[model samples]
Target: MKYVLEIENVSKFFYGLVAIDDLTIKVKPGQIYGIIGPNGAGKTTLFNCVTGIYRPEKGTIKYKGEDITGMSPHKIAQKGVLRTFQNIRLFKEMSVAENIMAGCHTKSQQKWYHSILHTPFYKKDENKYWKRVEELMEFFNLTKFAMTPTGDLSYGNQRKVEMARALAADPELLILDEPAAGLNENETIELTNIILKIKEMGLGIMMIEHDMDMVMKLTDYITVINFGKEISQGVPSFVQDDPRVVEAYIGSDDEEDEV
Candidate 1:
């Protein structure tokens, strides 16, 4: 299978403290890949590196066979890579529809001069993007809140808005950082359905999540990291049974329960 995102021996450091150390992983096209680890295990750091929030100190990252190791965030995003933060990062003052519109900026064809002069092409593009925003809002079941301020929505709704915004970019590979964080059980289940829907749309996903139940249910493959290094990786069941994975990540009690 063709891999959508590939990282080989990638490492990153902050003031001499290594956050990710010689880590390697790959997400195959159309797969829901899971990255699970304890706090400070560098899961978010890896996401940052892939999304160009932080440049790795070593190794290479390739997206669709192009080297993107040190590219800027905007450049990487333009290549169809998008990520959400562990904490919901929404334009609080913006309406839900406006927040989703932000992701369409890269795909907009209207020039600054066109916007300044209100050209016909600019109006046409604006209409097209607004249609897209509505489509995205409907996809996430957020159409009712389209005109409401983002800050007025509940936590789960905010997360849905974030996902909708990311989808507006038309990304091929979406990296989600703890998207289920702060969500209720029903909301998490809803998110799982949305993720699978995205996979059906031919988008590859790499998610950093702590809810093992949700991960096991949604992921095609699992990668476990501990202390900035990959400990084990395989199909969910295989990784769940790996003893080293249990000792280093999943506690022995959970291992026994699985057995």
Candidate 2:
């Protein structure tokens, strides 16, 4: 089967420091591919390369069989690759509905002039976009907060809004960076269920998460990285048991544990 996202022998560096070292992973449609490692393990760096924030010095990234290496972030989003940051990024002052609608601009076919003149095409596009936003709100159970400013919601709700905004763009491949970073246990549980529902939508989700329980529960496959290199990758069950992954996260018994 053709993979929805492929990172083949990819590498990236900052000055002389290697950030990603010949990493390779393929994500099939509807799969939750996980990337997990200790702090400073280059997990986010790998995500940056895939999303075009940093171009790999070597190897290639393909989406739907098209090479998209080094494409601008907006161009990547236009091609249906969208992402959320490790920290929440949202329009704080915008109402819930409006923030999601911002994501639809890329999908809008109306010209700027059309919007300025209130042309028929623009009206039609607005209607279509609103319909999508409403559907997403209901899906995320955020309809009750539709008119509230995004910043007024709790952290967990803000995360939901960000995910909804990314989905509004209609991405086939979604990259999530530490999605459960600040969420409480209950919120993380809710997020997991929401992600499973997203997987049911047939979208390929590639995520970097440090929450081991969440990773083990949500991921179909996982790649464990350390010092910018992949140390192990396989089904969650296999990865969880790998000695190398164990060493990377917790270190050998000989090494003194850091406080």
Highest-scoring model, lDDT = 2
lDDT of 1 by residue, 130-168 (tens): 999989998999999999999999999999999989889
Per-residue lDDT value at 90 in model 1: 94
Per-model CA lDDT versus the true structure:
0.92, 0.93
lDDT of 2 at 130: 98
Q: Count residue pairs with overlapping backbones in model 1.
A: 0
Residue-level lDDT for 182 in candidate 2: 97
- Backbone N/Cα/C clashes per model: 0, 0
Per-residue lDDT over 125-169 for candidate 2, one digit per residue giving the tens place of the 0 to 100 score? 999999999999999999999999999999999999999999999
> Any idea what lDDT model 2 has?
0.93
TM-score of each: 0.94, 0.97
Q: Looking at model 2, which ten-residue stretch has the lowest summed lDDT?
A: 250-259
